[model samples]
Target: MWAVRRASHPLRSQGYRLGAFRAASTKSSFGHDVDCGVVVTCVPGRKVHVLDCHSLPLLSAARHGKSVNGGYCLWNRGLSSQAGTESSGEESELDDGFSELENPIADTNLEAKAGEGEIGEGLVSDSELLSDDDNEDDAGENELHLSDAESEESKKKTLSEFLKVIVAAPRMKMDAALDKWIEEGNPLGRYEIHSAMLNLRKRRWFGKALELSEYSESHKLLDFVERDYASRLDLIAKVKGLQKAERYVEKIPESFRGEIIYRTLLANCVVQMNMKKAEEVFNKMRDMDLQMTAFSCNQLLLLYKRLDKKKIADVLLFMEKENLKPTLFTYKLLIDTKGQSNDISGMEQLFETMKAEGMKPDIQVQSKLAKYYIHGGLNEKAEAVLKELEGDNLKVNRGACRALLPLYADLGKADEAEKVWKVCESDPRLAECVAAIEAWGKLGKIKKAEGVFEKMIESWKKGVSSRHYTSLLKVYANHKLLAKGKDLAKRMVDSGCRIGPWTWDALVKLYVDAGEVEKADSILQKAAQQGQTKPLFSSYMTIMDQYAKRGDVHNAEKIFLRLRQSGYVGRIRQYQSLLQAYVSAKAPAYGFRDRMKADNVFPNKAVAAQLAQVDAFRKSALSDLLD
Candidate 1:
């Protein structure tokens, strides 16, 4: 009966046929009862199959063969080859069956474990099947699903496509989309999208990308965009592309508006001289109840200086109403603009008002005030500012001293100018005193100028620099003191100062003026040996003209030939001057008279016309002798 039931069981029908039956006393090493039916399949060769006997009553009956002629026959002759043919499929089926059974068992075990917690009963735990380390290994297996090369290539392709989009798209559209993408959590979109937007801003797209990025919290996008915005705004303003910047500013929502954006828009409008638009923006800022910074107000004042004074007065009145104290920059703009317009009385009143507000005039304001006084013919007032500045602990700036020195010199107040020069000379930072010395030279106060130059040289030797020496050399050259200029030039070279083309030209001209051709020649030769070809034609002409002027026709001709040999093509006047020198320096009887006659034969008009006039008079007197 058990054999018959086993043969008819589902396991046998699926080819896991049983061949024998055992009682419950039989057991296997894995702790399952061996009292299951053993299902056997007979083909050319014999194979055995086992099943749990308790779950297969029908297979048990088939194996026992109570309804068949065989004794405990559990074998099927055709089943063996079929089982072999379907081994894989049947194995999978068996695996699914085992897994299905095990899953319930596992759930029961879990429930039992949970029940153990409630009832304090001991149960086998999942820790027996696997350790935490094995769990980690399973995680590692999951991660291995994607290889490194595949992941990396996918990332690169994504980034490349993103960059292509950014590079090809219009800047405004790209920026807008970038803002939207960043807001949507910066997902699998290319990192280069943000980077490309940043690059566009760097290429001087100014506020476009930055305005989009401002409201984003992505640190990377904000950082790159702000850095690019700051870099390009100045250049954008310089090109008068402030409208593009204004377009960016207009996109900034009220909640995201800040001092930087406001300042940028205000500056752009000012630079474009779109004062009406600037005022509208400024008024919008005020209506927004944003605290206006001192810089913003100053920018408005600058725009007003160019646009409408009434608007400036209106802004000032608004400041008063807002209880905002006018800053130093506010006063500076008003003072400077008023001074430029020659509004002396108005500037005086404004200056007094600034002082009353406890804001002392800064150096810039004082400089403008000095200029105002000087221009209005109030030299005494300008001098008073200088004297007052001198007594104050505040360092009198070089610009202020420069303005004062010329005024004193122009007023013929040499004593005061000399005093100012003394103060400037003693101060190391006020090396612009050389400018005053040069001015004194221009005013033809050569002795005072020489005195200042001597002081400058002494100061320079003690601790000053080639800058001072260069300035003094220029001053000496301006005064036409060729000997002093040449001496200073040597001092500059000996001091290890680089003899730049300007310095070398000045020295060469000085030497040429002093008829020191040999010294100039030595300098040029040294420069050539050093492979420094500068002051090219100017230096050549200096020597040529000097010799021609001194009537040294021999040296002048030598210089002219050397210039031509040296590839100088520009000095036709020098050549003509040298020719005239040749005519002038000849012997009165033979060389001078014959040279005069030969001058007419050379048909070059510039030379021929000049020589023909000279020869005409000479020949008229000497026609009798020649005939």
Candidate 2:
């Protein structure tokens, strides 16, 4: 990555510094591929102007003349730099919101470029994507605890020179990128580093982002404040694991160990589904006498919404006792939890209460309401919510396309889905394109889905990342187009796209659907071994379900063990699948009750039914061998 060396011209003194970089697909030593995107500048006497580095105007500056404090060159953050786009560290990984410009999808840099697009297309002035990636209040994970003014200044940081070199390769060594950036005489303002890291994290390049943060830490690149420390802890949790993050926390100054820092740890614990640890961290926060934050409480709500429903009320009680007002995410969790339990009335009451308290529902809330309505067989209510979501202009609301596509598909409204697709097609983004593919696939239009996927390749060209490929791969997997799925997988490998969890899940399904269960198992095991990415919990369950169907008792047992070893310990689906495998083999599920008990998994009626079937065959210890 050849850093665009210092612009030696006197224009540098005039504060009209120039920089150029290309964004493209590239591989890195960091164990994943990345696409770069960042170009925000504050010119002399102009409101902060930010445009994508890959925009036509920016690329023009890179190739030809270089003098765009306004149009052609990068601007220096002199006395008047404004807050650029900030992708704050996220606490909850759930999809609970959407809107006209924001998608609740796996939006990476390869997709829409940032969380909840706060700036308009082409050129944005004064508008700031100050929103972090959090589902709760925008307090986000960085918990940098910097004063608001300090954070605003940090948001102004934008790296102009290095991205040019970054365009030359898919990815590079983190140290190498940073070293080259410094060698070229780029200013390592703390916030500019934040901007670069924000761009990288928005693109889902966690590995590279962590390397940059680590470099900043070791080099003392910026003021090592609580925010930087907290942000790095969150990154370490993402790139390495909880253990590494905790170890790093040990080295922090005792004074710097604040609420934001421990809350960051609690968030990661919830993400890993480590219930015991999550509770311990929550209690630790109380023990520290830190004022409980809605963000931290929301993290628990997210975890309980996934694991155990009964515990949700207890959290609500705690919130009431603490006089904590529910955040948007808190309401979202309660509404969703209520809806999933088929408690439609309760869901409505919670949503109404949210509005009664003047908490306006955004596109995300409406989309979710429509989703639950459709799921609960209330098509009229769902349509009413959908129509309300479209508001006054379906044509203008591009963000609704993603939420609408699947909701319409589930309702069997192909015509409606096509209408949503039309709005996106007029000027498609990567997120919209991916949604169209999934929607078409769901509607059983493989040809249309394939056509959408191809057009995506044509539009983005080399801008496509492995993250985008997962959507279409899933379409193929769902359709049982094994050959097509295999070909796509090969293309992904050949193009050197990052193979993360979603792709791994799709690959497993591809072989599983085609009766190559063993092959699917191997793919999952290998992905786990590489340790570059964590496999999704669903990916493991997919293989186990197939093994049970085939009476592959031993394989089912093996996968259940693997799942536990990987820290996916509390799910009951694995237990059910293992019991089914034994029943299919006409053999006893030895110690099945004890196994569930150990995992803290209590049997529901369905699980109890499976247990009864398996227990009937519990003849003797020798019966563990065969029927």
TM-scores of the candidates are 0.36, 0.72
Give the C-alpha lDDT of model 2: 0.61
> What is the lDDT of every predicted structure here?
0.47, 0.61
Give the least accurate 10-residue stretch of model 2, judged by summed lDDT: 74-83
Candidate 1 lDDT over residue span 19-69, tens digit each: 111111111122322221222332223432222222222111212211111
| Model 2 stretches with alpha carbons more than 4 Å out | 1-158, 163-185, 616-627
- Distance from true location, Cα of 94 in model 2, Å: 7.6
Clashes of each: 35, 13
Give lDDT tens digits, candidate 2, residues 156-228.
4434444444433245466776677778866665545665666665665667767777777788876666656
lDDT at residue 239 of model 1 (Cα atoms): 41
